[model samples]
Target chain A: MKNRVVITGMGAVTPLGNSVAETWEGICRGKSGIGRLTKFDCTAHETRIAGELKDFDPLRFVNKKELRRLDDFIIYALAAAEMALADAGLASGAAEGERTGVIIGSAIGGLATIEKEKEAIFLGGPRKMSAFTIPAVLANLASGHVSIRFGAKGPIGCSVTACSSGACAIGDAVRLIAEGHADCMIAGGVEAAVTPLCVAGFNAMRALSKRNEEPEKASRPFDRDRDGFVIGEGCGIVILEALPRALDRGTRICGEIAGYGNTSDAFHMAAPPPGHEGAVRCMQAALRDAGMEAAGIDYINAHGTSTPLNDAYETEAIKTVFGEHTRRLAVSSTKSMTGHLLGAAGGIETIFCMKAIDTGMLPPTINLDHPDPTCDLDYVPHQARKAAIRTAMSNTFGFGGVNAVLIVKKFEE
Target chain B: MTLEEKVISIIMEQLDVTREECVAEASFIDDLGADSLDLVELIMEMEETFDVQIADNELEKIRTIKDVFEFLKSRGTVWQE
Candidate 1:
């Protein structure tokens, strides 16, 4: 028999907030976390605004000496993992070291460190490069650092599927636990790619919003005036435990991982396929995996990226999958407030789904003032809604034509 | 600064140890609490600060603070007493 996985703990270090409580509060209040790119000099870049984090200090989670050696993404991942383990009431040494694992995801890990080292090499000589650069810049170090910190010895890995990375990590964690490879897994995604090169590169591709004057209202998902996604950075992590173990320990079950589906467009490097066939298949796969029908899902946390093509295509995909039930479904894009977290989007959004399942509150798509005619749907706009969500789905579509969907449901005996 | 003083400061900063702990006979790994990676980083810092390239073969010969001082002195590079 396949083991069931339950989410016992959740944590997030987001642009909206530093913790789950703060982020959820901002989501419920329709507050915008997007702002000017203050981390670096964006004078040369066309896209100046981003969902940059505020008032985050690594010292609270890591020592000063060690913090200097780690990249910002690794620090964020470590902080989120620490918060998750604590929330689960599991001491770092409580679980069997061999049965506990970590699988954190990132699209571009340690880009800041790489950029700094490159500058050093140019200004000074090759000898000026720091020896810690390799470990600090590798994408897998998010999981590597977490495993070493928490003493989790089993099946440590990382997923790097761009924007879908986090959701894929969670999905992989569920499979690991279901296959009895691990009793518990610390899984999610972290990203800190809000550096000069990342911003300039995205701007070159015209993938970021250039709304410098109005940063708060910049990420208007599914709106007629929406231009492109606003690049954001953060981390989100959750503790996935076997349902039986969680029940045996009397742990609080926030939600259950019912299904996960990952697919590829295989058409374009950066654009969705025609008719969003991949996304439709991806959602259908998730529903099939959960043994659920489209009508069974109570709400959908969309992958509404606030981009022109993504929003319209995702809407079409939803209409195709949910059919007539699309009108009644409470679909919203938390990215309207959080902006697009890229790799960390799926992790944080899944937590939103869990929050909706636990608290019966549907987060709103904040900046959906004038919805596009083609993208018309009930986006739970403007304010939070009080609705009993028994089953929720979160969607994440990334560059490289990757599509990932996760289904979560309220736990019951 | 003198060569010894400069080398000691670099070691202290890179390894995150105290001045008193960075004695001449102190081993980078044992007394200074530096792992292999830390030692490598300290070497990089030393190279950048002194503007001298320490080759890979020479790194294996220098394991102690005194060894580092002797290596730099033998390089015939400009240094103060």
Candidate 2:
């Protein structure tokens, strides 16, 4: 048997809130964080709304000098990591440095910084470039900065599998701990790509909702009126430690990471296969790895990105996996309230699964007044429901046909 | 503001230090806790603020506030005497 890994702490900086407690409260309340795009000028784009962070001042988390040298994504990652470490009560300096690692992923790193530097070069020639541009824009810097801040000297890396980046990172952290590479791992994802170029790119692909008048009602996953996803920016982090070590240290264990499955569709870059074969296989693999039957899963925090194709395909995948039990399962898409956080989706959604397991309250998929005929499963729509949840699964599919699924359950000796 | 005062303010802001810490004898790395990245950004800020170009070799010579002020003086940047 492999070493069991359990989640000891979690942190988040989402469009809904700046901490895990606040974000969970917002989720339970079914509050929508989507609003008009304020990061950049979206006058020419077809979609002008995004789930941008409100009142998040980086100075609260980082010093002014360090803030200027790091990108917004890195800042978000650092803040979330700090919170996670503090919650775990394991200061990086106090932990065995060689046995602690960090894996923070980002789909698009330093995009805002790149935009600024590119504009400077175009407007004022090459001499106008900033010296810290290179370090500020690299994707791995998110992990680098966190490791440096916490003094964690173990295996550190960043997973860049588009939207599945966070799930992949967390999954990889489990492998590292199982392999004895690290006893503790700080893993998560962060993204701050709500810039003009990102907006234009998604708008050009017609992958964004153009509901300018009603931003909150725009991201309606599984609903018949759903069009596309609303872009969001944030970070979510969790501290995973070996079960034995956690018990020895008397650390609080939120949940146990039972299994992780990752696969590639190899069909389309931006779209899933006709029947979501990859997603179905991913979930099955995770279930098999966890040594559990499909009927054992109590709730599912779906990848429902509020996009039409993703929602229908994910629903079909769920039905194919669970069959008759699909009707009994209470599946919800927190994205309905938080929007699609891209790479951070898997990380934040995983935390939501933990929350459900802890609280026995199933979060709702708000704005599902008229469900799509193809999506027939119970989505726990409109309002939160009270239910006993012991095991939960989170699914995340990225743009590059990458599918990742994780199964977490209530920890018991 | 005079050149010295302007330099002090920029150093204070870029290094996140106080005015007292920006003394002439204070070394950026030793006294002000600046890493390589901080030094590079400080140079860039100075160049933009003074509208003067600093060569790669000249960056090596700048170790202290006095060194930066002297380098600016050599580059024909005038200050209130």
Candidate 3:
């Protein structure tokens, strides 16, 4: 049998807040982080509103010089990892060197840096570009920087699967610990693609919310008036440790990572299949890995991106997987509050689900007015609920038809 | 303080420490808490803020804030105090 892995520390540099407690408070208060774009002028873009990190002074976490060399994505990851390390109380003591690993993923890394350098090259000569271009904007630098910062000597790597990158990273980290490759792993997702180019690309595809007027109510997942996702920036990180090691060190076990499953649709590049067969399979695979029945799960953090097609297909996928139990499951889309964090969605949502189980408080899927006729599940709309949640599943399906489901349960002694 | 000293102050500020914490005898990663990427970013920020182009070899020679300030000062870029 594989070893059990439990989450001991959690941190977030989300649009909701800079840390887990801050983000949770913001989420519980139903605060919306979406607002007008301040990074660039979005006069020409269809989707002007984005879930930008407001007043995020990077110097709080990283040095100014270091900030320029690394992309915003890496900054977010490192900051969140520092918070997680500190929270775990393992930042300075044992497990400081080896036996610790990092797997931080980003869907699109160093996008803003690339965009700026590309503009410089276009406007001036090649000599105008600085030498820090390549290392500043790569996908793996987030993990690379995290390892260097924290001195985590175990297997450190980054995964890039668009939206599923964060989930894949965490899932892979859990497997690594279970297989005895490492005793502890820092895993999560970070994305800093709140640039003009990203906004334009998604806007051109109509994959974003054009509700520039009402930014707060812009992301209405599962609602009949649902439009599209609001692009957000930040990172979410969790420290996973072997159960025995956690107990030995007296670490607080927030939740046990029961199962993780991932699959690719190979059918579409941007859209989920009609019936969400891939999503259904993904969730089922997780359940099988977890060795739990469908009726065992109490809450589900939906991949409800507020888009018309995604919300419909996710509803279908849940029903297809849970069947009659779908009616009994308490499902909600925290994306309704934090917006779609892209690669960071899976990690942040996983943290939310685990916290929900730990606290027995189900986060609400705010703005679920006039639910779509096709979705017939208890969405836990508008307000939080109290329930004894033993198992919770967090689902994330990315742009490349990549689907991932992670099952987490409250730790019992 | 000389122009070099003024430039060193900015480098120290960018590196996130005090003058005593980052000295001429210190190495970016070995002595300071900086990583490889942090050093690279420090070079870029120095170039941008000082208006002096730092070549690869010159950047490699910079181990501390003092080295950065001196290097920029030697390149005829006057630092403001």
Candidate 4:
């Protein structure tokens, strides 16, 4: 029999705040973490704003020597993993547990490291570059470094599925534990692509929001005025344990990772198929996997990246899947406040869904001043609402037309 | 700073160690907790600071704090102590 997988703990380092508590607080207030890009000069770039973390200290996760040796993506991944382990009450002994594992998802592994090292090599010789360049820039190093630090001996991996990377990583972890390959897994997604080169490249593609005048109001998901998605950086991780074992050990069960669905819209490389056919099939599959119906889900944390295409398409997809229940489902795009975390979007959005179920409150899609007429739905706009959300689903789609959906429900004995 | 002091200071900064760990007989690997990469970085830093490159073959010969001092002294670089 396949084991039941439950979430024991969660940790996050997001643009809104450093810890789960801080980030959740920001979300509940419909606060906007988006702001002007401060990582580099964006004079030449069309997009001048991004969602950079406030007052993040890598020292909390790694030593000084190690920090210089690692990249920002790895640091954020490690920080979130450490926090998750601590919350799960498995921090110190994780290294000794042969059954423990680590998985991290990232779209672009270490863009900052790559950008800086490229400049170094161009100015000096290849040998003049820092010895840590290779390890820092490799996308898999996010998982590799975490496994090394926590000494996880079981399965280890990194998911590079474009923007849906984190969701894919968590989905893989759920499968591993459910199939009895591992007892526990520290898994999540991270990104530090707020670099100059990435910004320029994304700008060249016209994929970023250029609303530099008011950064906070720029990410208006499902609203008619959303120009584009605000690029953001952050990490989110959760501790998943086999249900029987967690109950045996008397752990605080956050929720059950009831279902996950992954699908590829082979129709396009960067855009979804007309009417989001892949997304519709993916959501239907996730509900089936959960042994539940669309009516069972009380809320949905929409992908709602604030991009004109994504928000509109995602809303249409939701309508197609939920049909008559569309009116009852309290839907909101926490991305409206957190911005588009890309690969890390799934991780944080899943956490938001869990919080919604546990706390009985729904996070709002801020800046929804004027709802797009075609994208008709109750988006719980501008401010959070009090509600009894027993089950919530999170949706994340990536640049490769990859769609991933996860369902979390309140723990029931 | 003396040659010994200047070199030790670089070791302290490069290896992230304390002054006490920079004693004459302390091994870069065992005593100071340095790995292969750390040692390489230390050597690179010293080369940049001292303006003299150590031969690749000589890297194996220097394992302790004193070996670095003597190697630079052998280079006859103008410095004190």
DockQ of each: 0.63, 0.74, 0.30, 0.64
Clashing pairs in 3: none
Query: Sorted on TM-score, highest at the top, how do the candidates line up?
Result: 2, 4, 1, 3
Model 3 regions lying over 4 Å from their true place: B1-81
lDDT of 1 by residue, A69-185 (tens): 999999999999888888898865775489999999999999999999999999977867888999999999999999988889998888999999999999999999999999999
Give candidate 1's root-mean-square deviation (CA, Å).
Answer: 1.8
lDDT of 2 by residue, A1-413 (tens): 68999999999999999999999998999999999998887888788899988898899889988787789999999899888888898765664488999998889999999999999999989977888899999998999999888888999999999999999999999989987889999998889999988889998899999989999999999999999999999999999998889999998899999999999999999999988999999999999989999999999999988898999999999999999889889999999999889889888999999999999899999999899999989999999999998999999999889999999999999
lDDT per residue as tens, model 4, A1-413: 88889999898999999999999999999999998899988787788889999899899888878888899999998898888888888777744477888888999999999889899889977767887888899999988988888888899999999889999999889999999999888888999999998888877777888899999998999999988889999999999999988998798999999999999898888888889999999898889888999989899999898888988888889999999999998999998888888889988999999989889899998999999998889999898999987899999898888999999989997
Candidate 4, true inter-chain contacts retained: 0.42
Tens digits of per-residue lDDT for model 3 on A1-413? 78899999998988788889888877777778778877888888888887877677889888766776678998898889888888888778554678999999889999999999999999976766766788879988998888888888999888899999999999999999999999999999999998988888898898998998998899999999989999999999999999999999987888899999999998999999879989999999999989999999999999999999988999998998998898899999988888899999988999999888877888888888899998778999888888888999999999889998999998876
For all the candidates, what are their Cα RMSDs to the real structure? Answer: 1.8, 1.3, 3.3, 1.4
Model 2's CAPRI class is medium
- Give the lDDT of residue A361 in candidate 3: 86
The candidate with the higher TM-score, 2 or 3, is 2
Q: Clashing residue pairs, candidate 2?
A: none
Give the poorly placed runs of model 2, Cα more than 4 Å off. none
